[model samples]
Each structure stands twice: as structure tokens, then as C-alpha cells.
Target: MMNEQLLDSKFETEIFNSQIEMKSLFYNLETEIQSNISNLSDFAFESHTDLKQLIISTNVTLQDNLKALQTDIMQQLQQVTDQNLITQAIITDFKSDILNNLSAIATYMNNNQLSMKNNFSFTNSQITNLNTTMQTNFNQVIADVQNTNMNIKNNFTQTNQKIDTVNAQINAVVTNNQFQTQIDLLKQQIQNISVSVSISQSMTSDQYRCLMIAAWYGSYTARDNYFNSEQYLIYLTDSGCPLLKWW
Candidate 1:
């Protein structure tokens, strides 16, 4: 801005100086012409040829000086015009570059904002999904624990029933007098236990307890019936009624 103002001042000064030079040159020419015209009358007695040559030469010199001044003024104006064109072009390019930079910055900011919003939404969704999955897993664990407790309670009940059945058999053996009646009752109870074990093919802690109690009591009870005891043992082994289930 400062440089432009300085240039404009200089251009105006140059134009004003050129106008003054033109006015000065015209005043000098007019004064010289008036002096020659006054001298022409005095030299009227002299030859006409000298007077004609003087007038022609003065006119030619004036025209040449005017042409030279006009050319110099035009050259100065051309220089100022060229400087203005260069300044305008530079300003235009600067404005274009600044506008492009501003547009890029705005676009970058908008893209970053959108990306941040998307990232936040994705993070929130992940957190929600994680919470939902954790809740589901917690519920499954609770259900499994409940099922385990129910199974344990049922097994405990079955074991107690087996104990009661063993006590009843022991009482019957001690109270009854007939040897065949005691043998038959013992055989039936042993066969039932063997069948139950074979059908399961595996043993629970409660089932193992029942087997131990029955085996201990039956061993004592079957001492009087060696042949029948051997037969029951052979039947239990053949039926896969193993107390220890390695297979």
C-alpha cells in the first residue's frame, strides 16, 4: 500500500512536470515568433530568399522539439502503466493463493470433526456391547450354579434312601429265622444295586457312598451263603458293575 501510494505520487508529479515543460516550450516559441515577425518588417529591404529560409528553419526546429517532448512524456507514462499492471497481477495471485489456503483449512477441519464424531460413536457402541456380553455371561454362571446345587440335592436324597434300604435289609436278616428267606432277600437287593450301577456306567460321590455301605453290610450278611455270594459277584462283573470306573 505504501509503495503504491509513493508510485502514484511520483506519477502525478511526472505528469504535472511534463505539462509545465510543454507550456514553457509553447511560450518560448510564441515569443520567438513575435520577435522574428517584428524583425521581418525592419529587414524588408533585404532579400526575400533569406527571410523565407529563416521562417522555414524556425518552424522545423519547433516541430522537432514538440515531437521530442511528446515522446519523452509518452515513455514516462508507459513506465508508470507497466508498473501498475505488474502490481495488479501480483495482488491477484496473492488473493487466489490465500483463498485456496482458507478453503483447504476449512475442509480439513470439517473432516476431522466428522472423524471424531464417528470414533466417539464407535467407542460408545463397543462399551455398550461389552456391558451386554458381560451381563449375559454373569447370568449364565448363576444358572449353572443353580443347576449344580439342584443335582447335589437330588444325589444326597438318593444316597439317604439307599442307606435306609440297607438298614431295612439288615433288620430283616437278623429278625427272620428261615435261611432260604434271608438268602432270597439278599440276592434281590444285590441284583438291584448291580443293575443300577451298570445302567449309569459312571458313579457320583453319592452313588459311591451307597455302594460302599451296601458292600460292607452285604459282605457280612452273605457269609452264610458262599455259593450264592459267588454267583452275585460273577453277575455284577459280567454286567459292567465296576466300583472303580477307569474305562
Candidate 2:
């Protein structure tokens, strides 16, 4: 389409140039014929005769040549003028086609833009919905996680309290065992002393009396030392050993 338009413009330019050349040739020929006729007129006037036959013949020949040149110029001008009219028509048609094509392209772009705008609007709506859904799900997930954390914390607290209770019971058991062990040791020592004193009955009187005195003094001092502790007294009673009530 563009190439056709360019060819039309070139054709118009050539036709215009041809018209200019025709006009220039016509003007030059007309000037030459007029100058020759003026010269013939002067010759006739100088001869003082209306029948200047030689100058008249020369003027006739010039007129004929001038007429032929004028005819040729007129024909060329006519052809150029006809082509100019055709060029004008073609230019008008080309302009109309160009305007139509431009209008069609503009309309197409407008429609495409409108479609894109509608699509964008729909896409934006979908994006918004997706974001809303994501946010809602995120909130739900957060709430579930927080609730789980709270439950875990509660479980840990309850477990720690149970562990404390178990520890207290274990400590009580250990303390009771230690007290029983000490009582058993004291009972074993008392049994050994009793066996020794029974076997010493065959000893001399002085040695027997001295051993009894020492045992009495040790028992009296031990009773006075443990009088302030009820647990010690309970342990002694549980061991099957009782203090003598000599006081």
C-alpha cells in the first residue's frame, strides 16, 4: 500500500515537471515569433510599400513555424493537464485509503485496550479473593498453633507439679531409711556389749564392777543428749531397745 502511494507521488511530480517544460517552450517560441513579426513590420514601413513581398514571405514562414510550435506546446500541455487531473483523483483516493486504514487501526487498538482493561479488572478481583482466602487461612492456622502451644504449656506445668510431688515422697523415703539404719547400728552395738558382759561374769570382781560403771555412765549421757529429739526416741523404741528408768 505504501509503495503504491509513493509511485503515485512520483507520477504527479513527473506530470508537473512536464507541464513546466511545456510552458517554458511555449513562452520561448511565442517570444521568437513576436520578435520576427516586429522586424518584418519595420521593413515594410521603411520600404513605404504595403507589398513588401520578401519580408511578407519571411513573416509567413515564421508565423507557420510559430503556429506548429504553439500546436505542439498546446498538445503537450493538454496531455500534462489530463495526467494532472488523473493524479489529483489518484491522490484523493490514496488519502481516503490511508485515512480509512488509520481509522481501522485506531479502532482495533481501542478495542484491544478495552479487552485488556476488562481482563485486568477480573484478574485483580481474583487476586483479591485469593489474598483474602490466604489471610483467613493464615489466621486460622495461627489460632490453631497458639491454642496448641497453650495446651502444651499447661501439660508441662502439670507434669512439673507431679514431678515435685514424686520428689517429695522419694526424699521422705530416703530420710526414713537413714533413720532405720542408724537404729539398727545402735541395736547391734548394744547386743555385742551384752554378750561381752555375760561372758565377763567369770572375771575378777574389780574388773566386772568397773565395766558396769562405764556402761552406766555411757547410757546416762546418751539419754540426756537425745532427750530433746522425739524422732530419736521413736527410732529407739522401734529398735526394741528401751532406756532404763533408774532415775
Candidate 3:
């Protein structure tokens, strides 16, 4: 804009200078016309009268032509002035419209910025809430897992205690029972009976049967220790087994 204004001022200055030059040319022409008339009058004879009239007439025509040229120049200058005004008006209106658009754009940006800020705030709030919820849930899950682990540990401890109790009971029953003592005593009695019987290599069948009966009833079992022994004794009296019926 500054450059353009400078160029416009320069153009106007040039036009002013041209107007001054034209005015100077017209003034010089007028002065030369006066000098020529003075020279003609100073030599005026009856024969020079027609030449004087022709010079005067030519000078008037030149003056009229100069006036017409000045009028055209002034009209062109007026047109240039009007064009400059129109251009200035157009530039002013363009500046105003541009300023208005810039203002509107700024306003629009502000409104959108406010809306975006609100949206971001809402999103941030939601994210914060989600994070809090996740933290709570995560903490709860951790507690549940700890509880589960504790329960598992408790159950395993109980199981181990129960196994220990069962092992203690089994050890007591195995170590403190009288069955092995009874079995050893029975074996010793059987050895004593065999040694007594080896006093004779030969024996009657009845005597052998008596010794077998003594081993069966006394060493292996006792009739007085049974609750329902009479039925078995009756069956044994008529037993079909070869060893029981040898007598």
C-alpha cells in the first residue's frame, strides 16, 4: 500500500509538471506572437496590411487550439482523478470486508476453541473416573486373589495336619499291638512240642493224631475262647479232609 501510494503521488507530480510545461509553452507562444506583431507593425506599409491580418488570424487560431488542448488535458486529468477516487473506494471497501471476515474468523475460532475445551474437559473427567474405577476394581481383585491364596494355604495346612494325625495313629497301632507277641509265643510253643515229640522217632497213629490235635486246638486256637464253637466241633468230628479223618 505504501509503494502504491508513492507511485500514485509520483504520477500526479508528473501530471502537474506536464501541466506546468504546457502552460509555459503556451506563454512562450503568446510572447512570440506579440513579438511578431510588433515587428510587423514597425514595418507596416500599405502592402504589409494583408500579412499583418494573416499573422493575427494565425495567432488567434493557435490560441484557440491551445485552449482546446488544455480543456482536453483538464478533462483527462478529471477522469484520472475520478478513477483514483473509485480505486480508493474499492480499496477501502476491500479492506473493510477483509477486516470484517477476519473478525468473524476470530470469533468462530474462539467459539470452537471453547467447545473443544469443554469436550476435552469432559473427556479428561471420564478418563479420570475410568482410571479410578479400574484402580478400585484392581484393588478388589488383588484382595480376592490374596483371599483365595490364603484359603488355599489354610486348606493345605489342614490337609497336612490330617495326614500327620493319620500317620501317628497308624504308627501307634503298628508298633504297640500284641499280635506279634502272640505269634512269637505260639512259634516257641510249637518248637517245644516238636522237641518233645522227637524223643521217639516212631509213634502209634493215635498218638500222632493226639499230637496234631494238641497243636491245632492248643497252639493254633483254644476251644474256651470261642463263642459259637460247638457247631464247628461237631463238623470237625465228621470232617472229610484226610488230615482230620486220619484216626
User: Candidates' lDDT values, in order?
Assistant: 0.52, 0.50, 0.51
User: Per-candidate TM vs. native?
Assistant: 0.26, 0.29, 0.33
TM-score preference between candidates 1 and 3, better one: 3
The sequence of per-residue lDDT tens digits that candidate 3 reaches over residues 146-234 is 65556556655655665565566445534532433443444444454464345444444554554454346433332333222355356
How do all the candidates rank in terms of TM-score, highest first? 3, 2, 1
lDDT of 2 at 143: 64
Model 1, range 33-54, lDDT digits (tens) per residue? Answer: 4454334322321322333344
lDDT of 1 at 120: 74
TM-score of 1: 0.26
Q: After superposition, how far is residue 28 of candidate 1 from its true place, in Å?
A: 49
Tens-place lDDT per residue, model 2, 120-143, is 776456546656765665565566
| Candidate 2 Cα errors over 4 Å, as ranges | 1-116, 119-122, 181-247
C-alpha displacement of 77 in model 3, angstroms? 99
Clashes of each: 0, 0, 0
